[model samples]
Target: MKLYEMRDRQSFGFSAENPSGSKGGGTRGGDCEKLRPCIDIQPGETVTLCETQGPGMITHMWFTGYIGHSFILRAYWDGLEEPSVEAPVSAFFGCAYDENFADRDGNYPVLNSAMVLVAPGRGYNCYWEMPFHKSCKITMENRGAQAQTLFYMISGWHGAIPENSGYFHAAYRQEHPVQKGRSYTVIDGIKGKGCFVGLSLAAGMNGHNTCWVEGEAKMYLDGDRYPTMNYTGTEDYFGGAYAFGNDVYQHRYQTFSGLYTGLYAILGDTSDTYNHQKRFLLYRWHVKDPVYFDSDFRMVLDNLGWTGPRYDDYTTVAYWYLESPAPTPVKLPEDGEMVMK
Candidate 1:
């Protein structure tokens, strides 16, 4: 099963099985521009994006629209009721903050990687190789106030997936106003064998003139009560030093869109709460160095700031690959809790 061996083509999208990009099955272009059909999902309605029995791999997924935390995207593997991948549409693709954050100059901050890329034109793309043996299902829900217009495509090929390939999993969690002297759990309730791959975080401070970079990331493996692997601070885990240095420039060593890690966004303000309500978005991928766990895995981040302890709002989506499906509750935050202040 070579990757580029030219297999059969299979695409599930909004199109009506049109071979060419033309409309009305004619050569001319008069009223044949209905090639792309978009859907409007009202609140509380779930729309099935893709469902197929496969011995194939999903090669590419591309979606772009006004997606936010209120729009939930879920993916199910095999015939499981629980979704293996569930998160807000924006956060799932590594865009944690505002979607429309561009000025007249068209300068906007975004995060991009080999697997996930959020382009400047609001095009969200995913190139993860999701291989399933029995079946695969993908759905989207509109949990927000206004209706959502979605235009997307899921393209893949029919072939036998590799034997040792693990199932991909992603979970979104958050702890509002992190407790003092306590740790915020990024991922937990795992009951399978998997390797931690990547994580994206959105941190917001709630205190006046408070600093949120004095935290550390910890990973507990295989029933260990304490973390076997721990880092010094939050910024350090995201490939930064000295509170990101306020350089306002992307550096190689500090943090940028490289191969393994990146610091995507840092939204700070001087007026609100004396800059204590500022927010930061950071991400790290364990592509080269994955945290392998056999029995279970848990990840946490310290709430310690610069001076003693602190409290803040922390939200994250943890990405991993598991040998067996570690079914966890797909409980999302309430409508009020999901909204970012």
Candidate 2:
């Protein structure tokens, strides 16, 4: 019932030795403003980010770095070998393509929402409440060639978790040149009761086609033979209309960034290239309204385009909560398949 924070000021450990001592973290005797100054974030190694035995709920998380697809973040709940949450740190934070969405040029735009935010300083923040009954473990893996340093903070309350509380989960998936007559899986392998909370989708056209916004998203819940929930089109799912103002308007780009939904980023050249092979970063949060599921859940996105079926690259991050641990291990892609490029 009480709140606790684990940060570098406390030697990056959560110990409730004295309730009032945390305020002194950045003081003279404490570690001070010198937060985790990393010499190296080693490659091909899994570093334990946070581990705590006993029940607790992870309330907030923040991370900033030169994130790429090679950096993977994972969290295991209640001693489960398979991580309940797994995604590339970049994609998980709602940006993809192994690129920083923050810069002085204002080309790559940052997203701010109720559940997740990618800020101006390349900072990523999440307020998903993750409850664990037995233990919680978080880890980061650097799959890149060189060492990368970053700043991060994961703080939550440790004590008795609610009996009805569900465990938080997010998954990352990507498909290049989506196959013909098939839908892209956003998140699957879900079991037990849960509520779908949010989705982040990034896509890029494979060719110089202008009609790549006709795709629709679908949600399948609880053993449904077909999708129980369907969207009109991909742009509609992210609260946009009319090809995201791509076809009709002569402008270089049109975007919408709001509290619940964001058509945040559009990559295009202002010259003769037009919006060809344009890249986009979009997100939607189901905070005010959650999709409740009893037994299972699966989500998919259609690849149909206006000019006929089209193939495009798709990457997504799905956020949800489940009553029980996942039935099977959440296997991450192999090292060779993890690169974003």
Candidate 3:
């Protein structure tokens, strides 16, 4: 169908105003009435955001309020016992580490991309189309020490799901001070057929080095011992070269956010801890160039630099789509392990 084309389909949405997503829902509320604008989740509590029968595609999602690692986000498709998607709320949207959210001056990071949009004031939005044949479920777990307020909306269209449509999945991984002389595994233990679509990399140099972006991205597909694909360097993989093309004006390495790739967040000696090191947040979406695999896949990045292997603190969120519902390989770490100071 072209723009302005017509099709027989029904639209629905879930939110605090209308938890059921029923037809003519939220009609009971009035202008500025704000009868039910949000929900609060206490510590150690899990809230089901959306749970409904599906033969539909989830088109968009918007979330705010305490939008960081304190909350865990998970999604299940086709009534699977295991969630196909799991990760911290922040990393799923390309924001990782505590210092990357904002500075003392209140300058929020911005990422204008084809799949995600992170606006000021902690607005986290995703445009990934998640299709389910039988049912779909999305939940949030508050792992923080205090209660958290969540404002959200899940919207989509009811239609016939294609037989070959893949289910979306995302997982988070964090390693403080990567092992010396060893590469950090971005993602592994991937089984079945799917395409790796997006990646979020948050890094801080634990040891001295000219830069931490010297690592090379390697991908092993279909049980290959060696990598079949490689990104020359970390910067090159993010569409930058020679330390992200130095910005003479600011007297620092340039940072930018484009449609599919970006170095969006930068923290310089402002962290509560790790003050001696600098941290950077970057993202890449394989929207135009997806990594398709039939059997299995794995991706790793070497922590190398000018001198030699440079151990660093690294974290990431890997996103993909598979033909069937499957849980991510990486398990969510404990709260103490996920925190970044």
Candidate 4:
């Protein structure tokens, strides 16, 4: 069963022959200006971008100064609207290069950083690999400065599938901007363990803080389902560890033995005033356990031997299990390729 691909923007509409319709079907076409390298997904396989040509893999996506843009990759399983899994593209995880602030209306300062430029000729490219069974749709929207022009160069694999149950891992280089206050980024919060990892520079005790908030990523057990977990920490104890703050103040111990979801980052207090590019990086991991603090899990930070901010470039791997058998097998195209019509 190969995934369906519709080239014509109008093909997204409803047709008796095509029940599922097209991507963003019945919605405003203007919302998504279909670019090139459109792809179809296969169940349980990996997609490699370097194997193909054209904009199939994204090299660079540029937004005009002060304008806000969002790129969403959605997966549809069994006619569902929202993707079973989704991740946003931004500077928080260091996948982006430049960062600048904007007012409520999304306008930027006059001396803002230059636009992200796509390499000349044909070297621009980006790749997305997957390890689950799903149908995917990638959408990029310019929500701010409607008239601004955006340029995105992509080159890579198209709709390849992964053989396991993991998601795509993204890494990139980023150039920090010289702003008056500290900048923050959100790294991964889509239905997994609520743990988050963050990195930041030190300025003073005033501008140092780290936290993990929980609202989503709850899993079902045999008879009991656990609620979300929230934890916060600062540089106060053992340099920095974990703490608690929110509606209630209580110690919530967790085990990573089951499914989890959450986001993590380091935040600095600029209101009280702190100067200096404090380079610090941290990671937050959240897990749900029936037994609070019984299980012992060690947190290890491996230095892959890179320069710059210690947290600038790092990889996070997690381990969990599902008691049930594997998910249903997804159909693949007859030609052993994604179907793009």
Which lDDT tens digits does candidate 2 get at residues 1-341? 23375432222332222212133443243544543344247778777767876577777877776567777888899999988888889888888765534322355577878778877767788877788899888888888777887566777766666688888888888787678668888888788888999889888777656567787889999999988888999878888887778767663347778888987776654344754456778899988879999998888888777667777888888998888866332466765675544
Q: Give the CA lDDT, 0 to 100, for residue 120 in model 2.
A: 72
- In candidate 4 the C-alpha lDDT for residue 136 amounts to 29
Residue 18 lDDT in model 2? 20
Where model 3 places Cα greater than 4 Å from the true spot, the runs are 98-100, 103-106, 246-251, 270-275
User: Can you write out model 4's per-residue Cα lDDT over 1-341, one digit (the tens) per residue?
Assistant: 34495432121222222223334433233545543223322333222211121112222332222212133222323233433322223322221212333312233212111121112221112222222233323333322222332233222233333343333322221212212222222221223322122221211121222322211222222223332232222221113323222223443312111112221222322232445221222222222232122112112221211121222222222222211112112221122111111
Q: Write the per-residue lDDT of candidate 1 for residues 220-332, one digit (tens) a residue.
A: 99999888989999878888786676433542213366556777665655344444466666778888889999988899998776677788888888888888654553467
| CA displacement after TM-score superposition, residue 332 of candidate 4 (Å) | 32
Question: What Cα-based lDDT does every candidate model obtain?
Answer: 0.74, 0.74, 0.85, 0.24
C-alpha root-mean-square deviation, each candidate: 4.2, 4.7, 2.3, 17.5
Candidate 4 regions exceeding 4 Å error are 1-80, 84-88, 91-128, 132-135, 154-163, 166-341
| Candidate 2 regions with alpha-carbon error over 4 angstroms | 1-35, 100-108, 247-252, 268-276, 327-330, 335-341
Error of 3 at 63 (Å): 0.8
For model 2, the run of ten residues with the poorest summed lDDT: 12-21
- Residue 295 deviation, candidate 1, in Å? 1.1
- TM-scores, all candidates, are 0.86, 0.85, 0.94, 0.30
lDDT of 3 by residue, 1-341 (tens): 49588866799999989888877887486677878889999999999988878799898999998887989999999989989899998889888874366643347878778788889887889998899988999999999999989999999988787889999999999889899899999999999999999799988767664666778999999998989888998888988887686423433566789889998877656443543767788999999999999999899988888678888889999999998999878888997678786
- The CA lDDT at 152 in model 3 is 94
Question: How much is 294 displaced in model 2, in angstroms?
Answer: 1.5
